[model samples]
Each structure stands twice: as structure tokens, then as C-alpha cells.
Target: MKPPTVFMGEMTNREVEAFLVDHQTVIVPTGSTEQHGPHGPLLTDVFVPQEVARRVAPRVGALVAPSINYGLSYPHVGFTGVVNLRIPTFMAVVEDVAASLATAGFTRIVFLNGHYDNTYAIAYACANAADRLPAGVRAFPINYWDGMTADEAGEFFGPTTGLHANRGETSAVMAINPDLVDLDHANAELPPFPAVTNAPAVHTAFFFSTPGSVHRASQSGTWGDAREASVAYGERYLSVVADATVRMLDDVERTFGAMPAR
Candidate 1:
């Protein structure tokens, strides 16, 4: 049988209800609208998760929610076209979305997040929403990058990866949407570590500079070399991640079924 088509923003309410009735799980792709060096498109971060959602949803009989295209990207504000939501606003959005899914009888809600900055905010939203959900309702916020192992990173990115607009991210974007990437501009630059590091800074206030200043801190907007990125390599890396996600969803579904009702 052909895989189910993901529900886009234009999907009707009746269609959404129909999918929920047939599927027990829902996947929400979250990404940021920010600069991704000079080579990758600003939408790269979002596209990775969205693509993963597109590939994985049908396998698990899950419906993909409309992608959350905007995220907390204040650190990249120095760059053009970067948009962000304050912590409070981001949390509210996550909470509202999760709560709405729970009310609609979606027992499993998986947040497929691609942006590093969204980690804590999405986690907080999931935790808070979980408390108010029905006993069987389950929600998980997961970072696509976090799902990879050190070995996987080493194999795919080697030694050059330095976070942000790095090799892995650049490769991912190229793999998913090569037409949007401008390889001629791909460059690598590593940021300097601060002498006096503050305790793990979580809020956007920690990095209030514009994208230009942020870019200035590094050799180039990119933290790792994207010159080696290839569509074939990207496909392999994506498969690894996608396989792991499928297993995790299965585990979550099984665990949810075994849990006692509230």
C-alpha cells in the first residue's frame, strides 16, 4: 500500500480527524527560520526535521502535523530573515499544540525538532503538557541531532563539526533540498570558546548579539566544512537517523499501552 500523505496546513478538519481515527501517533516537525551560513538556505534547519517526518510518518502509521517553521533563533538575529519567539511565547506555542493533539485523541505525539536552540523550550513544553494530559496520552520532544551516536557523527561529519551551520547540517540540507543550497559560498569557521564560561546558558539573553556579530565570532558563518558533503553520504546518515526514530516510536507506543490509566 502507498504511504499516507502528510497533513499540510491546507488540510481540512475532517481529513485531520480521519487520520487521527486511523493512526495512533502524530509527528510534529519543528525548525527555525534563521541563517545557515552562506551555502545553506535559512530553511535548512526546519527542512531536515520536516523531511524526516515525511519519510517516517507512513512507516509507523502516523500523521505528520504542519511544520512549525519558526522557532527560538534569537542567536542568529544578526543574519537577515532570521525570526524568533521569546521563551514564554515558544513555550506557549508548544503547550497549546500538544494540548490540542491530546484533546484530539492522539495518544502519541512526537516532536521532531531540528534546531539546537529549541531543546529546553520544547522539553519544558512537553513536561508541562504531560501533567495535564490523560493517563494514556504520551508526548516526547526529541532533537534529530541528539538521536545520532558519537560514532555516527564521527562517520558522517568527521573532525570538523563545530555546531550551528556545520557540515552535518549543511549536508542534510543538501541531501533533502539541493536546489536551495549554493555550494559556491560554503565556508568553514570555528568559534572561540569564552575564557570564563557561564554556567550552561539556556535563555536567549545569553546571546543577544545580531547574526552579523555572531558570524564575526567565527571564521565563517559555517562551523564545519561543507565542501565534502554529498547527496549519497547524506542519504546514508538520514537512513541511520530515520531507522532509530522508527524504533523509538515503537518503544514509546508499546510503553504507553502498558502504562496504567490515571
Candidate 2:
């Protein structure tokens, strides 16, 4: 059987109304427009999450809204292609998008995030919009990497991986669009991991507060070794991310079911 049109932008108004009759869930991809080292494209943050949404939407009987391409990228400001949105602006965009979907009758909305800096903004937007959302409409903002399990993480990132435009992200993008990856320019920049890598409070504060720190840490804007990245590794990363997203959708369905017929 042919698959339903999962992209919201592709459907006619009537088709959308009909599709929503059966599927009350929607996925939104949120990403940043910024530098991702030399090998990764400036669009990496947008591409990875959007592609994950596209791949997972069909399995969960959901529609994928158009991507929120610009995000909070202050840390990467020194880079040539980096573009950063103010926190309020980024959060407002996400809130309005999710609220619109909720008003349109989607009871479950998921924001699949790509950029490291965009996480809090997306979550804040969803959380703040909750009270205004129609009854039973729930919004969740989650990172695409959250889908990777410990074992999967070992396979994808592990000891060799660095943060930012390192192995994992480069590989994920390569899987999505090999043409976008320029491995010849791939480089590694491993900064000293903070002494306590497991302190949530400390890490959270550091991640949120330090934007210029990227400049101080690595000249290449890279965190890990991308030389280890490969098409096969990228495919594996994507499969895990998509599978994880589908599982999340399943949980949403199991907990919320579909909205009562209008």
C-alpha cells in the first residue's frame, strides 16, 4: 500500500483535514543555522532533525510540520556561517508553531531538536504553551540524539566522538545527504572534558551560559574526530534516531490515544 503524505506542506487543505481525522499527532523539527566544523554543512542542525521527522512520521501515523530552521547559536557566532537568534525570539517561534498545531486539533506535538543550543529554547516554548493549548494537547521538545541508547551511543560516538561538529553529527548528516558532507575538510578538535562530565547542574549551566566558549576551545569549531565517520556509521546513527523517535510517538499514543472525534 502507498504511504500517506506525511509532510504537512505537501497536503492540500482538505487532505490535511482528512489526515488529521485519523492522526492527531504532529512532529516539528527545530534546528540552528550555524557552523558545524569544516566537513559538516551550515544546515546540519536543520537537516538532521527534519530528516528524522520525515522518516519517523509515517511509522507513527503522524504528519511533519515544516522545519524551524533558525535557532539559538550564540556559541558559534565567531564562525563564518553561524547565525544566532535571541532566546526569546527562538522560543516564541517554537511556541507559536506548536500552539498553531494544537489549535488546529493536534493533541500530541513533538519538537525534534538538532542543535545543542536550541534545546532549552524549544523546551521552554513547549512548556510555556501548555496552558494555552487545548485540553489534552501535549507538546514535547526532545533532542534527536536522545533517541540513541547507551549501546547505540557506543557504536556511534563512543570514545572517539567529540561534541559539536564531531563524529556523530557529521556521520548523521552524511547519512541524510552524502553530497552535503566534505570529508576532505574534516578535522578533529578535542577539548579537555570538564573534570566532572556527569554533573547535570554544572553541565547545564555551562552549556546554557557559554556561547563564546566555543571560540576559546577550538579554532576549527570542531569537538571530535570526524575522520572516523563513514556512510555506514551514519546510516546506523539515523536508523537509531528514527527508531527512537517512533518509539516516543508510540508512547505518546499509548498515553493519550487520539483526540475524541470532533
Candidate 3:
């Protein structure tokens, strides 16, 4: 017999009801539609977490829920084909999604995040929805990047490159589809001017945190160099993230026990 479907989208209402018989967990992957430099696809944020969630759910005995494709990504909005929701709007959406899952009887709703900008919004939204959740039903978010070690991430992205459309991310996109990324046209970029320096004026980490900072800092829309990105590294990154996510989900299950009967 074929293995059971892992994606909720592919399951019918009855299938989902059947799943709930033994499973209370569901992975909701969230990503953004933003420019990821010239080499990376606009959906780079979408693809990464979706892949990791799928890779993780079977091991964790969870189903992968449909993803949230838009996010609070104003920083990359200046580029072509970018769409960003206002912070309040994104938070509202996140809360609604979580609340919906809770109502649907999914006791453990995990928002697996792929975008940097969606971090606070997801966390705050989940927390905000807590009052509405039925007792024992829980919803929360986790960044996929957090699954990797600093040293491991540093290996793929290098120290100077922030998480943007850089080596690590581009490689991930390549792993999903090599044709989607154009290595020949790829460029190595860094924050211009004082951003590259240790000047006290520029707090290096938050330099690109401001809205529209990505556009103002680099015309190519890349926060770091894509020159070093490789499909090999992408596959490895995916494997590492997948394994780590499995362990993380294990911890989540152990930490939060069972949900009440819905």
C-alpha cells in the first residue's frame, strides 16, 4: 500500500477526521513573496519552509497544512513582483489561521516560518490568539533557520552575509530547482557604505531591518553574495534543516502533551 498523504491539501474532510484519530499535530509553513536578488526566485521564502515542513511532518507524525505565501516584507517591496502585508494585517492573518486550526481540532499547530520579517508578527499573533484557543489547543511559530547551528549556517552563508537572498538561501532554491536560479547572472553584494564597516552609527545586524532597506542598500536586491551558492550546499542545507526540525518537533511534542478532545 502507498504511504499516507502528508499534506493536508491532498486530504479530504474524512481523511483529516481520520488523521485526528491518532494525530493532533499539524505543520503550517509560512513564507513571503519578495524579491530574492536576481538569481533567486521570488518565492524563495515560500519554498524553503514548505520543503522543510514536508520533510519533517512524517517523522514527527504531523500533517503539513497549507502555507501562508504572503508576509510582512516591506523591506523588499521596492523590487519587482514583491508583495508585503502590513504588520497588523499579517498578524491578524496569522492569528486567524491559528484560530481556525484550533477550531478544526488540531491541538498542536506549528507555524514553520521561512521569512525573517514574519518572525515577530507570527509570535505575537499566536500569543494573541491564545485567549481564543480551547484549552489544550496550542499554536506557535518557529523559524527554520533556528534549526541550524550558528557554525553550520555560517558555513553556508558565511559570517558577513545576512540571511537574505544570499548563498544559503539561493542554494536552497537551487536544490528545489536549478533552473529557477541563474548562477551566471548572480552577483555578490554587501550593504553599501558604512554598513560594511563597524561604525557605531550602523548597528550591523539591524542595518537591513528597516522597511525598504534592501532596495536602498542594494539595487540587485541581494543582501549578500550569491556567487558562492551551490546546489550541493542547498541539498546539504535542506538535509540539516529537515533533521533538526524533526528533533525540534519532538521537543515540542514532549513539552506540550496532548490536546483536549475537540
Candidate 4:
């Protein structure tokens, strides 16, 4: 017999409506198509979050929606194959996507994000789409890496992880598929401007950038040590993200299940 999958795209519409009989939660994977230095795939942002959403959905009795694979990646526009949407366009897409699912009766909507720029877009989309939805529905806009500790990043990435196309992301992609990366081409190149790397996990010590600043600062589009990436580190990242998502799923149900259905 074929085993069940959490991805709703693979299921028939009947199967999806059937899922609502037992589950009201759905995870929407958000990402981008942009440069990841020389080695990492353009879709690394999407693939990483997709891995966690796929791994955790069945365990949480949720379904994974089709990926929102393009985002507002203007900085990477200088690079080939970078497909970025305007900020407003991305938000509209997200709003419609969320609204469609809510219309289908899913109450707990999760936007699992991989790209940093999409942060505000997802939040704003949720707000715009919420008022029109049926009562009791809630949308969660999340950056999956927010769950990672500075210590965890230090342990796996040897003190350097996020920023862009670096060890942590490259390693995670390598674990997903070695063929997706070519380590020989990997290299490190931080932004030319001053940037602090030692803030706490959830806190920021510096402001991000001016418009087009990232493009001016990074020629290669890598902002961390990509050479340090490895398959081992990627495996750990997958496990960590999946574990964190599972725990959050529990919190969503416990905290909101008691509220009257909207």
C-alpha cells in the first residue's frame, strides 16, 4: 500500500476535504529563487523549510501546502536565475493563498518561511487575509530558524551559521541532496560594510541595511563561511527544525483549542 504524505498537492481534492474531518492545520512553505554564492542551490531557502514541514506535518496531523517559491529578493537580482516578486505582489499572493485554505475550513494556518525578506510580507498577508476568514482561524508566520539557539548554530556551524548562503544553509542542502551542491566552488565572502556577528540568537546588535546595500556589499552573494558546510551538519539542522516545529504544533493546539471556533 502507498504510505500517506503530508503534502496536500499530492492528494486528491476529496482526500483534502477528508483531512479537514480530522485536522484543521496546514503548513505553507515560503522561500525564494536567488543566488546562494557559487555552490548552494538557488532553492536552498525553500528546500530547508520544506524538509521540516514534510517531516513534522504527519506527526502533527497537518497537511503541507504547495510552496510559495518566489519572494522579494531584490538584492540578489544582480545574479542570474534570481526571480523576485515585488513586495506588494508577494503579499497579495500570500494573502490569497491563506484565504483559500481558510475558505476550505482549515483553522490553523502556518506560513513556514525560509527567506528573511518574506518576514514582513507573510505577517502583513496574514493580517490582510484574517478579517475575511471564518471565525476561530489563526495564521502563524514563522521563520523556522528562529527556533535555533546561538549555541546550536555554534555547535553545528562552528560559531557561524545564518546571514546568507553560508555553512548552515549549504550544509542543510547538502544533507538534502549532495548533488544539489558543489563544494569545490564554495567560498566565504561577508558584506564589505561593518556587520556584527555575535548577538544573542533572538536579539539583534545591528540594523540590517539600506536599499540595494546587500548587492553593493556582497559580490558573491555569500555572507558567511560556506566552506565549513557539510552533510553531517545538515542532518542535525533537519532534526532540530523538525523537533522545534513539532513542539510548536503542540503549543498551537493547547493554547488555541479552547477558544470558541471563529
Cα TM-score per model = 0.84, 0.89, 0.89, 0.88
Listed per model in order, the count of residue pairs whose N, CA or C atoms clash below 3 Å is 5, 1, 0, 2
Report RMSD (Å) for each prediction in the order shown. Answer: 3.6, 3.5, 3.6, 3.3
| Better lDDT candidate (1, 4) | 4
User: Candidate 4: lDDT over CA atoms?
Assistant: 0.82
Which candidate leads in lDDT?
A: 3
When summed lDDT is taken over every stretch of 10 residues in candidate 1, the lowest stretch is: 197-206
C-alpha lDDT score of every prediction, in listed order: 0.76, 0.82, 0.84, 0.82
lDDT of each residue in 136-232, candidate 1, tens digit only: 6878887775556678757655335656666667777778978888888887776665555442342234454343445456545677777777777
**Roughly what TM-score does model 2 have, to 2 decimal places?**
0.89
TM-score of 4: 0.88
For residues 191-214, what per-residue lDDT tens digits would candidate 2 score against the true structure?
665677575676566657888667
Ranking by TM-score: 2, 3, 4, 1
The candidate 2 region of ten consecutive residues with least summed lDDT is: 153-162
